[model samples]
Target: MRPLIRPKMIVSAVLAALVLAGCASTPEPPPAPESTSAVEQWAALEATELIDQLEALPLDERPRDVLASVRQDEVVVSAADGSREVSVPIQDGHYLSIAPYLDRTHDCFFHSLTTCTGEMGNEELTVRIVDDRTGEVYVDETARANDNGFIGFWLPRDVAATVTVTGVGGTAEASVQTGAEDLTCLTSLQLT
Candidate 1:
């Protein structure tokens, strides 16, 4: 019998090859914050920008020697093996990165921007977010999970909303808040 080949692995491999070949296109990056070094400039970029840049690089080019974490007000990038660090402030709204899982998940409060994984990686999903109290729709679009199997969202600050994600396995719903105290890593939305 042929060895088992999961569809997800194939997709992930294709995506990885595209990234390694620099065929995956990202929007023109905005002006970098004034800094002394390239790493410093990258570290000072907004959360989305940093993630985009990191995703665009070839595996060998990424700062694998560093680490990433989210705080209530900022995304922190620091050298994993050293003492260098930078805090990129959250601007405009709250950055909420979610990894909706199907079969497994890990306990996460603040998202590890560099290393969190979800079961539904490399899948397309339809996500919709609506204001729970005012009935205002915030987001309704098709989103693709990144290499890490996570989709990040920027929500209006301090609002309570209902987040519904539709994936291949099924749909999942959860309540979310974009407050100063809310968790940044949302991983409990298991598709049923």
Candidate 2:
């Protein structure tokens, strides 16, 4: 008897061929262009100019000073735990205070078989200050909180700067502007 071809086998072969052909004939689409806002475009331009200026300078010679472009009466302080916006007064020769607290939490799993505990503290924080105009690191030191749970820094008149604080709890950053006229204490920053 002549060998018989099964209909199911023919159908399976045809299906397999169709799938392979479909995959082989498919073309990948081009990547989409990145969308950017007006602010982003301006920032990109500024960054490019900065890079070019730096590249032109000699290896040992530092780049030109970058003036503080943005001025604010307040700054947003952020940390891993939380964030807050603190207002700073435009006054010269004023002290800025920051207060942070410690919080504790515990987690238990599997009927108390597994336990995890953590503490967040804002003590002996590493604080840094940068001069925006000159691109210089003005201060980098550890700030110890007083008994009242506050850390203070003196600000010079007519200066704009960025401050960064880091501790076991988290980290925070802010930009501030000092008044042109010398004045007494007026500004404070609180982070928790």
Which candidate wins on lDDT? 1
lDDT per residue as tens, model 2, 4-60: 999999999999999999999959888987984322332334322422232233333
In model 1, residue pairs whose N, Cα or C atoms come closer than 3 Å (at least 3 residues apart or on different chains), thus clashing, are none
| lDDT comparing candidate 1 with the true structure | 0.80
TM-scores of the models, in the given order?
0.74, 0.36
Off by over 4 Å in 1: 1-41, 55-62
Model 2 Cα shift for residue 48 (angstroms): 44
Model 1, position 137, has a per-residue lDDT of 94
Residue 42's lDDT within candidate 1 is 68
Candidate 1: tens digits of C-alpha lDDT, residues 27-131: 689998675654476686877788666643443455666777776688788777657888888667877777888889998888876667677767899999999
Off by over 4 Å in 2: 1-92, 101-122, 180-192
